[model samples]
Target chain A: MSRLELRHMRKAFGGLEVLADISLRVDAGEFVSILGPSGAGKSTLFQLLTGAEHGEGEMFFDGAPLDDHGRHFAFMPQRDALMPWRRILDNTTLGLEVQGLGRKAARTRVAPLFAEFGLAGFERHFPAQLSGGMRQRAALLRTVVQERDMLLLDEPFGALDALTRAAMQRWLEQMWRHHRWTALLITHDVREAVFLSDRIYVLSARPARVVREIQVPLPRPRDPTSAATRQAGVLEAEILDILLNLQPTKGHDHD
Target chain B: MASSSFNPRQLAGFLAQAAPAVISIGLVLVAWELYANHSGIKPTVLPAPSRVFEQAMLNRDALLDNAIPTIRATLIGFACSLSAAFALSMLVDFFQPLRRALFPVFIVSQTLPLVAIAPLVVLWFGFGLTPKIMLVALVTFFPMLVALVQGYEATEVEIGQMLRAMGAGRWRVFILARLPSALPYFFAGLRISITYAVVGAIFAEYAGAAKGLGIYMLNAKNNFRPDLVLAAVGVSAALTLVLFGLTVVLQRLAMPWERAAGRRAARKGPQA
Candidate 1:
């Protein structure tokens, strides 16, 4: 189990601020999302966490200060980032190999999960041979197979079509429920956040600030379109209202 | 590819792809054959295709004998050049200072005329296989080096970011991502250099050699037997095509996924 907390995190590139005094937390076995508009410095916060960039912050993991160079997170970029040359199975084992795990051993550990990841019989198929949804699934499998304590997913299914994206969202929730991995998803789609997360952090535009932390009291296996799930729709509208500036100014406002 | 069973459709598809090249070459050959017959330039000066064919048949043994040496030089020289290019590119890729220091020297090597350099090479090494192989290696090295460098640079930046996030080091990234991405470009460089390899070997022999197509052509030209010269020319061209075909086969064997990707694209159509 792993828990992550960030307090007053800030980042800037040269003179331009990207993340400004952002704060968030995720409990062990919880699924959380940072929902923001495109280019709202959401990825910058990830970069800070990954230690790929420097930022002013206090970050703690599992009740201890986060190590700047710890190998505790698995990242899935917006693109599948699948090597065009590697087959799906080999792609899934990439992280293991990078960490000095032998190829044969890594394959032994990863081959069984192909079925669970819905990639059965695709072990030898190149990424290009698979459909868009399958490729994204392969990418997700690659992320989780590392068995990292936390997952930092940046729009993993943003490239898929609407139907595929929605289907993937449901599939992701099923996987998260089964494995209960600590996951942090970065997305702009309010419905995706509402469907897949235990908590949602709505972020403002550039020089991003965490505007709201909303809890999801919905039951498991959520159906975002269900009439009974009126709360899901209400939360989506509220988040949209914040994003679109449909609400009047508040005390938290900064010029 | 080896696992696939026989398919006549494969042959037909191959023929379809070859059609444009065949048609263009056939049109040019027919025009040349007609012009050679009508123009009536002395056979000793510019032999007609028919006359050259007769000469080629008459001296087939000599042509084959000379061809062996040229082929040997081409093969050995190209192998050395490829190995050297691979090693140097790895060095350049791994070390920034070497890349900055050596890239300009690599480009300058290509600028030196092979004709000017070949004689000096033979004069230094003496009339032997050493000079021929060295000249060929020198001529074929730069294009491959450039291809590898460009291929390394062409890797997608996001891919590297993802790999770094995975805890992969510089060496692992090179082996897994950079090397695989460069295979297609390396094969392209091989095809380009191969044609030059044969020509370079012949030029090396022309400087001074006891055997090879170059020596054979020189003797034939001295005897005013342009037909034999042209026959040797034809043989060398044929040699280049054969070597080029070998590279294509090697490429297919090395990167089977490329063929698979093509098949997927074809099946999925343009929209995909």
Candidate 2:
């Protein structure tokens, strides 16, 4: 079990500030979501979390200052980002391979999870052969197989069709329950945040600050049409109202 | 499409595609024969195709002996150059400063005339296999090295980032991402280099060689046997065609995706 905490995270690119004093926390085994409008510097925040880009912030994992960014977290970029030349099994084993696992051992480790990820027959297939949904599953498998302290997902399901995205979100929720791993997802999809996260942090546009923190009062095993899901929807609407109000004012301020 | 069976329609289509080139070549040969018969020029100056063919048949033993050395030199030189180019490209890919330093040198080296250098090589190395191999290696190295460097650069940025995010080291990223991506480009360069390999071998031999098509041509020209010279030329062309075909076959075997992609594109038609 791993809990993640960020304090007063600030980022700037040249003179254009992207993130400003953003703070958030995720308890052990909890799923948290960052929902913001497009170009709200969510990617910038992810880059900071993954140590791809440096930002002025204090990050802690389970009460320890998060150092050695390489080993601590698994990062899934916005795209599937699987190696096109590799077979699905090989791609899935990449994280393990990077961690100095031998070919035979990595293969042994990942072979069983292919079926669990709905990719059993596709172990030998290349990335291009799979659908968008399957590719994301493989990408997720590649991320999760590493068994890192936390998973950072950047728009993992944003590219999928609505139905596929819904199914993947459900699948992800099921996996989350099974593993109980801490996950921080960056997304622009309010419904997705409402459906999958225990808490959602809504950010304003550029120089993004956490404007609202909404605890999802809805219970688990949320059906798409159930009262709990509707309650989550009400929360989603409330967040949407905040965003709609902020956009015009934010646009005027930018100019 | 079955490998075991021959379809008549397919055979007809193949013949139809080949007919135009065959007919044009036949016409050229006929015209040359007519000119040779009527112009009253010495056969030594401009031997007809028939005489060249006859000379080739008559001198088969000597031609084969000479042809073997030329083929051997070309193959050896090409292999050496391929290995060297691959190593250099990998180095350039690994070291950022090396690319900055080496790319200009690579471009400059390509501009050096083989004619001016071949004699100097022959002078330095003597009339043995060494000069011939060096010339071929020099001529074949540039295209493949450039192709490989460009291919390395062409690796998808997102994929590389993803690998890095997974905690891959520089060498691992290259082995996993860059090398495989560079293959198609390497083969493209191989096609150019393979053609140059034969020509380079013959030119080096021309400067001075004990045996090979270059030596055979020199002897034939000195003996005023234009037909024999043309026959040697024919053999060199055949060797080049054979090597080029081999490269194509090897490329197809190595990159099945290229063929599959082509078929997929054909099926999908054009995209807007």
Best by DockQ: 1
Can you tell me the DockQ of model 2?
A: 0.31
- A49-127 per-residue lDDT for model 1 (tens digits): 8878889989888878888443778999999999988888899999999988999999999999999888899899888
What tens-digit string does per-residue lDDT give for candidate 2 at B1-90? Answer: 357768887799989999999999899999998898789988989998988899899999999999999999999998899999999988
CAPRI quality band, candidate 1: medium
Tens-place lDDT per residue, model 2, A1-255, is 337889999999999999988999988888899999999999888788777789898988788898778777898988898877778899999999889999889999999999889998888877766778899999999999999988999999998889889989999988888898889999999889988989999999888999989898787776777777667778889998888767846345431
Instruction: Give the 10-residue window scoring lowest on summed lDDT in candidate 2 chain B.
Output: B263-272
Q: Hey, what RMSD does candidate 1 come out at?
A: 2.9
Chain B TM, per prediction = 0.93, 0.91
lDDT of 1 by residue, B1-272 (tens): 46476688998999999999999988887887788788886777776788899989999999999999999999999999999999999999999799889988988888999889999999999998899999999999999988998888888776887888887889988998999889889999999999999999999999999999999999999999999999999999999999999999999889888888877877843221
lDDT of 1 at A68: 48
